[model samples]
Target: MPATAPDLDSRAAAVLGGGATHAARTYRPAIRVARARGSRKWLVDGRELVDYTMGHGALLLGHAPPEVVAAVRAQVEKGTHYGAASVVEVEWAERIVAAVDSVEQVRFTASGTEAAMLALRLARAATGRDRIAKFDGHFHGWYDAVSVELDGAGRPVPGAGVPASMAALTRVVRADDGDALATALSDQQVAAVVVEPSGAHYGRSPLQPGFMAEVRRRCDETGTLLVVDEVVTGFRVARGGMQELLGVRPDLSLFGKVMAGGLPGGAVGGRREVMELLSPADGHVVHPGTYNANPLTAAAGIATLDLIVDGEARAQADAYAERLEREWRCVLSDAGVAGRVWRLASIIHCALDDPDAQARLPGALRERGVDLLHTSGFCSTAHDERDLADTVAALAAAVRAAARVRR
Candidate 1:
């Protein structure tokens, strides 16, 4: 019997779909986490694991940090949300504006996906252009227009439920080469180019600094708006998000993840003149969300940002991630596993050189005593050398287990 999360999780799986609301939480052979504190999680069956997932990159300060939890508890006791304006909402806006580079004005949304949809709409209204350019494999969100990709026929197909016309307006290109972007933007009707400054898939396929700079140059020359999607990398990357790390400013930016500190939230920010397109002065764009800045989420966001800036948490996360990546690589290598590790700040992804390796990896990692972070791992201040060491050992053992299996 698995010695981890047996009590609460058995009940959770019986009632909850796959035992968790989020699909990522449900893994083969089961990994049941009962509760978390600081950077550690306690299983219902009494096993403990270092919490590297860190709320899917949302907990910059680590799991249930005392400062953040206290802020949340204080707010919860008062009330979870007011359904009306509050000082906390105002504080959230001010903190976001101060932290991000391209943002001079900002608006909140329920999730990062909503922010991406809003940014695309505002770009069309502002420029009066219909077409948009986005890189291949960069996830903007679950939104309609951004969800499209080229089908087997080499024709772009709308993601199910998205208006087909919206898909038609999107131009897809590879993220590897910046020069290809110049050719696409030659269109006068192109309203904007939306990019994830981290390259793609939360930096799984990263872009070189020069490639991003080149894209910026082309957008400026063509008079096309540049929208940088920072939902995963926003506050998690640095105080200013990827904009500060890349040193390139976008016309518009989408932020989420760590900003909410485990609560649901999103924000769209950029220059005042450009963001003004969403208001009465232009009468071209309007963005309204009933739960945009719910007091609960704002309270959480303010506390998260305050910790990020004051404690220099981003640097600390990066330092820890570097060591974690190196240790895992060595372990997997010594085990004669063909897998390799990739990282951006604290986000680490391990993929095998073998095309089929990933499908089996998530299962094998769980067999060893530690809960695998699906295909990737996150590093936080709450994790120590032992946690890092254990994860590396898990990777090594998991790889060996897979090696013994025949296709």
Candidate 2:
């Protein structure tokens, strides 16, 4: 097993940059998954680990969900690609439109990043403004426009490969700072004020109560389009995402992850007038992608959406997460570990008092046969009592291990 692991590791390093496709997927001691099903994944060495990543928040129904598998299987037999419009795609979009109140029209993209990019483009086109504003630490995607972060002075600092001039067009403000947000939008040159209603890092830094409503009001006052990046929250948080929970409507909403049923897909749904910018009649925003609403994705998405429409899946996941949150908080307290556990819907976040312990927590969990998405655990409807108990024990051990490590 060790011999095979090193060989495969070397091969991956040679072919795949960083030995992983996505940055988040990379691990300290690279893990190779052999297979997965229902809240657990087996490593190449045949080690089974409780999976909390849950397809990075896509698998609300859990891994290899039967309905999605059946749908994708049936679609593959019919056709993988038609090079034209698809009925499954239409149904998927219909479900999104019906589920989300703010989304009157929707357009699919290959990934969340692309969906975010499209939303910004549409906002700029619809408002005829060059500048955009986003809250600091609220990551929309990896695209140039949304890649910038704010420094300590609250100044916008663009990531590498972003032009200074392009960075100049963005305004960065704190998500909890309503006054700052108001001041940022006062100029009225901003096309869109994009945000994650749950705040940055999937509620690690949660929005203050009523912050979203205030954001909506500010956007309305300044005539700026509000784009909510719900890529991580859509479908997983609720049927309609954070906007529904917050009772605020945005001009544009981004969807991905759970909305795509663990497939590679994303979407921008928004007001009909603004979305019409992409229509042939308007020719305002042009979007083209090879895999936009591809049949496999649409099939999985449709099946996933159908199951979650009744809110049962979300309820189940949330219930499990609630238990996890309670138990984990107790674990930290009982173990005398300086950490706190919090949750937003089905997503659980564990923050250590020591920054180094926080950094080591995920790796420690992986070693204890549990995998997390950073310091967060994404619960699924499939997680049951056994998985919960095991995860709790693993978390307790991992916290102790992480806390013992010296800088």
lDDT against the true structure, each candidate: 0.80, 0.91
**Which residue pairs come into collision in candidate 2?**
none
- Candidate 1 clashing pairs, residues 3+ apart or interchain: 5-44, 5-45
Q: What is candidate 2's lDDT per residue for 1-407, written digit by digit as tens?
A: 35456678888889998788887977758778889999899998878999998998889999999989999999999998899998888899999999999999999999999999999999999988999999899988798888889888767899989999988898888888999988988989999999988989889899999899999999999999999999999988878899999999999999999989899999999999999888887456889899999999999999999999999999999999999999999988877888778999999998999999889989988988989999999999889999988988998888888888322
Candidate 2 lDDT score at position 57: 86
Q: Name the lDDT value of residue 135 in candidate 1.
A: 87
Going through the candidates in the order shown, the clash numbers are 2, 0
| Window of ten residues with lowest summed lDDT in model 1 | 1-10
For all predictions, the C-alpha RMSD in Å is: 3.2, 1.8
lDDT of 1 at 158: 74
Off by over 4 Å in 1: 1-20, 23-27, 44-47, 151-154, 281-284, 405-407
What candidate 2 gets wrong by more than 4 Å, as runs, is: 1-3, 405-407
The alpha-carbon deviation from the true structure for residue 397 of candidate 2, after best TM-score superposition, in angstroms, is 1.4
TM-score of 1: 0.90
